[model samples]
Every structure is written in structure tokens, then in C-alpha cells.
Target: IDGGLLSPEAVAADPCPHGMTRELCGLLCGDDDPAVTVDPDRPVGFALALDCQLAGDSPELLDDAQLLDVVEGAERMERWASALRTRMLAVFADRHPPGSSAPPPGADSGAAAPVGRWLPDQVALTLRVSLEEARCMLAGAVRFAHVLPATLAEWEAGRIDERKADAIAHATSVLTDEVAREVEARVLPGAAAAPRRLLQDRLRRTVARVDPQGAARRHERAKADRRMSISRSDDGMASLWLSAAAEQTEASWRSVDRLARSLG
Candidate 1:
């Protein structure tokens, strides 16, 4: 299923109207050739050709290594953009530090809180995002720049994406700065390629190992906030949410299940 490039002579002989040579187009559609049936496991060799064609450029025939470089280059650019945003957000927070008492442009300063309580509002208006989203972004930026310098450096270097860096930041946010750095040292190396859930699990494990008492304290605080609620959707369905101790939640779920089955 490895894709092969046509020789210059072969490409010149059977040029396709679609810009690609006939042999290249056949990689996408093999209905006429029984031996050239599509391979399910392999990526189509000329997949990126369509992008180039759509961009109004003649497709340059690329080998597998070249295609890989194209994808990696795009990802690197994305990481750079994320890094830039992080730096901008951190700068924004710094300029509007607590007790700035000056409203952002297009905002009222008459009733501004003594502290920089309007930071989220400023971010939301500037970015056209929800207040919650703005707050999360600011928090992540703060953590990235101040709390987790190594993670930030990895992200800035394009070694890891924003999500991986944020995952590390959030996981270590509860630990002391020194302990967080230790956790980062242990987990940051493999984080770039780890699946989100696996990375989160590893971060939690590392956090618990480094700060067992803090983890226990957090669990107790979380248990204190346990409650339940239900919300109705427009589709005539209601969703129930439970936040309780694990054992109690499991017992309640079993009771509900048993009652429902009895009625059935």
C-alpha cells in the first residue's frame, strides 16, 4: 500500500485534466484496476494534492517524508500561535494586576472594584469570548508563565501543544511550586504524545506521590461540596447529576437501578 511517485516521463505522458497525472488520480479511485483496490490501513498518497489544488496551485508530487514534513510544519506553527497567545494573556494580566481599579477600554470605571476584578470582563470583551472562557484562559496563562516555566518552555519550543501544557499546569496547580516542578520533571518528557486521559492519570499519580497530604485534603474539600441537581433539556429529557462520596454515589445508583428494574 506504499504510495509510489510516477517518473517524470510517465507523468508527462498521461497528464490528467484534474492537474494530477492519471496514475496519481488512480490512487484515489481504483475502480478500474482490480489489483489496485484501496488499502484500508494506509493513508491515500495524494491526499494533500487536493489541498494544493484547492489553493489554486499546481500540486507538487511529494514523497512520504515530504508529506510528513508538511503536517509537522503545520503543527509547529500551531504550537507557536498557542505560545504567542499565552504570552499575550500573561502580559495582559500583569498590566491589569489586582487593584488596578482602571477599567479596560469600552468599560465603565465608575464602580470598578478596588482590585482588578474586571480582568475577565476585559478579556471577554477583547477576545469576544464568554467570561468563563476568558477566566480559564487567563488562569492557564498565569500558570504557564509563572507556575510552570519548564512546561511553558516546552510549549514555546513546539515540543508540546497547548493542551499538554495546560494539563501539566492544572495537575500541578494544587502542589507547592517546588513540588510541582518535581512532578513536571517526572511527567513532562512523555506528555507531548500521551493521550489526554493517560496524561491526566499520570499527572494525578505523580501529584499524589509528591504531595499525598495535599491530595487527601483536596479530596476532603471536594467531599464537602458534594450535592445533587437535575436539569431539563428542550428535548423533553432530564439529566441528573450527583456529586457525593464515591461509595455513597455507587450505593444510590444501585438503589435506583433496582427500583427501576422492579417497576419493569
Candidate 2:
């Protein structure tokens, strides 16, 4: 098998790690593989081979090695996606000031400026995963960074309540047209991107105002409860257990419970 020319059928015949579908594999492989062509009928095999290479194996897309490779690929994709988003945002900020009250002179009166860039081949080379994986990452990052940052800023400034912040965060992830329009109307206009120091100050002030005594006590408790311990199991595996005190544990647990409920 040339590995690159193998069909989606071939990939389905021999599935990659965790039995990833051929369609997903195709998304992961794109056009970077020298032997792989962009025939949709034969994309999966190439994707698998590319994934295998990324997993650090000489042979392409080993079945047994798929899990580790998938995890590594996911992590790399996420990191690259975040980096791409940050870069794209910087570009956008440079091109258009954050707080432009005046609208762009165009047909669309109330639309956001296009925010992302097509990934060049050179940039894909710098990424740890295949070009296709990199693209998926970039898409996700752009969505999150663009949608979530404004709501988070509002939350930090105490302009929006936590419940509202949570709603905005959740909606930002799933919102497509209507939500985007709403954000453009309410949040985007007069949205001046603050400097890092100013942002941090706003966050601190908001958090303090939310619960001054609780924040102080939490800070003090965190300072007081730093400890580390190391132990070895009989099976010859070493284990490190780092723990905080009862107050910290309780606080963390409560936070987790709240988050879980919110997600639910």
C-alpha cells in the first residue's frame, strides 16, 4: 500500500485510534502528505498515515499507537488554534480600533469585520500536527476567542452578573447568527480593548467587590496551605501527591459543583 492513496474504505477497514471515522481522518490529513491526493474517496488513509507520522512512529498510523497520537494531536491542535486566534485578533485590532463608534462604509451596516486568516503552508509546517488538524484548531480558536472575550470582559468589569456571564459564555460557543448579531449590537460597539494592566485591575476590582472578605480569606488560605509529598508504590511506580487544606478543598469542591450544575 502506498498508504497515501488508500481509500476511506481502506481506512474504515483498518480504523485509526479509538476507531475514528474516515470523515474525521480526512479532516485530520488535508493535503500535506506527499503520497496523498485530495480525492474524498481516498482521503482517510492519507489522514491515518499522517497521524501515524505525527505520533512519532516510522510506520504510518499504527493501530496500537493511535490513542497516544490522537491525544498529542488534540493538544497540538488546541495550542496552535489558540496561537492562531491571538495572532488574528492582533491583526484585527491593528486594522480596526477597538472602540470605533462609526460603522464601516459598506453594504452590511451592522456586521463584524472578518476576523480570521487562511493558514499558509509555511505556517502549517511550524504546527506539530497535519495541516487539516491545524485548520480545525484554528477554526475552534477563532470561535472561542472572538465570542467569549467580550462577555468575559464584561464579567470582569462587574457590568454583567456571573449568571449572565455564564449564559454569554455558553451561548457564544453555540450561537451562530442571531447571537452574533446581538453581540455586535450590544457588546461590539464601543468595545475598546483594554491594556493588560487595566484588564487585570478590572478583574481584581470586580472579584473583590463580588466578595471582599471571601477573596481575602481564600488568598490567605491558599498562601498557608502549600505542601508536597512523594511516595513509591509496591508496583515500582512513583507517585506525587500535592494537597491543600480543608478550607481550600471545600472551596474547590463547591466551585466544581457549581460549574457542573451550570454545564448541566
Candidate 3:
């Protein structure tokens, strides 16, 4: 049975101290009749009213042209949105700039608890995402805004997607700001034509030449995080994953291949 929004029973049972008006309730419920119940899964309420209203205006019959138009629009706009997200995050960072004194003046240095310490938690609650997921997203936004202008511009122009932009940012992370920009400028021109691994390799070489000291430091830091794990796949097959230096990983693979061949 469909629930009524403005029915007397609903008004009487409403949580508000003062009964909700039928007019206000009608506006809140937004299918065909404002007085009807809202199904959140297939929402036509105040939240999705604009989009729902536009979709309703279109003919029920959707042809190939309409479908293609929607897909194309989504692809283009997604890139634009990625660029805009960087800007939005820039504003957010300014408001709560990292290293900006979390505490006010005159407070004891040890006693000052940083403001916005719960930023990731706040973002998680607002976006209905896990804290780890929120931190990852925030990290990506910061990278795109501050680290990868060339990649962000490419995405804005619809030449690349968010994944490739992030890949560029992460691959060049160890370089100094000047070197990272130089590497990005050199790599982006051929990005659309090149495989992702090729770009990563090029970035690695660029880092090794441009800032060898920084690269070595990063390598040492990465070595601290290296490990291996084994797990069973859904089909009961065993799988192994290793995090290690590229050179050592390749040597290990080669040794394993030779051992298997000798056994055969």
C-alpha cells in the first residue's frame, strides 16, 4: 500500500512538534502528486527533484541517439568534474591549510590540539564513505591540484581520465616540484598514444636523472613497505602478490622460471 504524505494520520504522527503543513509536505514528496509516498531507492523526492523532473519531461521511449548522447555527456562531464574537484579541494585546503597552526596563539605548544584533526572522519560521515576511503580521495584531490597540473589540464580537455591523471601524479611523487613539472610536461604530449607502463618507466628514468638523490631516498622508504602475501582465489587457485623493488622482483621471477624449467 502507498503511504500518504499529507494524510491526517501522518501529520499527527510526525516527529515535528508543530504539525507539518500539507503544502510543505506536498513539496517534500515529489513524484506526480506531491502528496504521495517517496521510495528512496527509486527516488523522486526533494533530493533528486531536478533530475527526476527533467527525466520525466522526456518521452518514455529512449532511442539509440538518446542513449549515446547520455554516455557522451557523462564522459565529457566526468572529466570536467574531476578538474572542478581539484579546485574545490584547493578551497578546502585554504580554509584548513596543512601546517596552519591548529591552535590559536598563546596556547602552550605541547597543549595545542590541531584544528580539523577529524577532517577525514567528517568527510566520511558527510559522504557516507569509510574513513580510509575518504583519506584516499582527499589524497588524490591534493595530488591533482598541487602535483599534476599538466595531467589535470589534460583531463579537463577530455584527453585523459582520472586514473591516468592519478597515475602521473603518483609516479612522479618522489621528484622535486620543478623536476616533477618537467617530467609531466615531457610525458603528457605522447600520453594518449603510449601505454601506461611506458609512461611510468619514462617517469622513473626522468626521476633518476633529474633528482637522483630524492629517487634513492624514496626507494629506501619504499623498501621499508615491501612484503609478500598469498591468498586463494575464488576458483580455489593460489595467488601471490609481492611488493618489492622492480629490479629485485624481475631477478626473482627469472630465478623461479629457471628452477621450474630445470625441474621439468
lDDT of 1 at 162: 80
The TM-score of candidate 3 is: 0.59
User: Which candidate number would show the highest lDDT if scored against the true structure?
Assistant: 1
- The lDDT values for all models are 0.72, 0.47, 0.65
lDDT of 1 by residue, 23-44 (tens): 3455545536412222222222
Where does the lowest 10-residue lDDT sum fall in candidate 2?
34-43
**Residue 155 miss distance in model 2 (angstroms):** 24
Q: Per-residue CA lDDT of candidate 3, range 108-226, in tens? A: 66755554565666567766989898777777777667777678777876566776777788878766677788888888898866777887787777768777888788889999999
lDDT (C-alpha) at residue 239 in model 1:
94
CA error at residue 67 for candidate 3, angstroms:
8.0
What is the Å distance of residue 205 in model 3 from its true position?
A: 2.3
Per-model TM-score, in order, reads: 0.63, 0.24, 0.59
For candidate 1, what is the lDDT? 0.72
Residue-level lDDT tens digits of model 2 in 1-264? 235555767867875664334434554466444222222122224353445344443234344444554544444444334444445643434454434433343436675443233232223565666767665545443443555556544433333333443333333343454444354345333333454344444544544554567567866777776776899889789876657775876787798789999998
- Residue 236, candidate 1: how far off, in angstroms? 2.5
Better of 1 and 3 by TM-score: 1
Off by over 4 Å in 2: 1-61, 99-264
Q: Candidate 1 — worst ten consecutive residues by lDDT sum?
A: 34-43
Clashing pairs in 1: 99-115, 99-116
